[model samples]
Target: KLKDAHCAILVVKMKRTLIMFSFILLQLLLGNSLSPKHSSPKPNAEVTVMGFVYCDVCSNNSFTRHSYFMSGVEVRIVCRFKAASSRTNEMITFSANRTTNEFGLYKVAITSLDCADVDSLASSCQAKILSTTRNEKLVDRL
Candidate 1:
């Protein structure tokens, strides 16, 4: 009879733990859903964007002609998607701004949450040179 009572007590404790855990989980879900930044997004898949920043030490019109691979430059990656609505097109965009690594490379990882309506398409995303960390001196021919 004592053994049976102990087993019954154990079962009750286990049930209470499970119920409490579930309630906490539900509350977290509700809290997340209430926030605009924490929108619903499927997990397990991610998008990584990477690039390098270089300085044209010499005056050059070609991309590969740049002399120096500049570091410490701030880069931004913007992903956008457009859909037609009524008469105008609606745009959805996500942006990640980060500085470059030691190798002058910048990486931006966009999860489904980061990309609201955008996809991992070449046309849907873009990167532009914002500004350099420091101003460079110019030389004039005498």
Candidate 2:
């Protein structure tokens, strides 16, 4: 009778351990599935440049309360990227013309296999207002 009792106690302990292990495994799977996933940009992915065109009404070289966004403005975007590796003497250039939307926002998409990472974009990209179709119909070059 003592041996039977011992076996019963061992069986109960085993069942408890199995239940705890199953709970822990279920928690791990659920946590992994519910967690937000962070994705890094893949190589050769398209890069977009976006900005707003605003008229500096005060001419202080900055936006003020009097300033307003200009729609239907023609903008030219140019980007030049050097080769990722210094061993290769390769340069990629991207140029596109885009018109500002009603919100005075312009977006240019550039896709190239030779594109450098985002860190190098600041030094390699340029955008300028090619023309403005406001009431004055002024054309400016930069």
Candidate 3:
């Protein structure tokens, strides 16, 4: 009788362990399936193009110790992206105007579904200075 009770206790423990393992496995599967999918950027994702406007005090076409960042400078950003697939000859152009902040930083946030990544923007994007609050004229260095 003692041997039978020992075997029955072992069987109960085994059943409990199996039930716990199955419950854990089910929870893991459900967690993975219920999670949100974000393999790529959303349709309304915002891409920011930011840069700083600085004056080349030395006029050697490079930033030096005498150079300073200029504030309240108007910058125009233009980005052209080709269609993802070559089947369509569609060229999407995004243009925006932004003014430099106190830190001489200008930012243009573009919300578009056409822009896939920043790599595309780096190849075909251009930024030009439209105007500045200062008396000096601004030139495109990059």
Q: Write the per-residue lDDT of candidate 2 for residues 42-126, one digit (tens) a residue.
A: 6676678887888876666676788777889989888877657767757777789999889788897777645454556657777
Evaluate model 3: give its TM-score. Answer: 0.62
Tens digits of per-residue lDDT, candidate 3, 1-142, equal 9999999999999999999999999999999999997698555756777888888767777777888888888888888877565577677788888888897888877775454544566667788998876765344443
Candidate 1 C-alpha error for residue 56, in Å: 1.2
| Ranked candidates, highest TM-score first | 3, 2, 1
Q: lDDT of all predictions, in order shown? A: 0.65, 0.76, 0.77
Which pairs clash (backbone N, Cα, C closer than 3 Å) in model 2?
none
lDDT of 1 by residue, 1-142 (tens): 9999999999999999999999999999998888679556556445677777665566563345445566777777887765323454667677888777786788887665433334424477777666676665211110
TM-score of 1: 0.49
Cα-based TM-score, every candidate = 0.49, 0.59, 0.62
Error of 1 at 37 (Å): 30
**Colliding pairs, model 3:** none
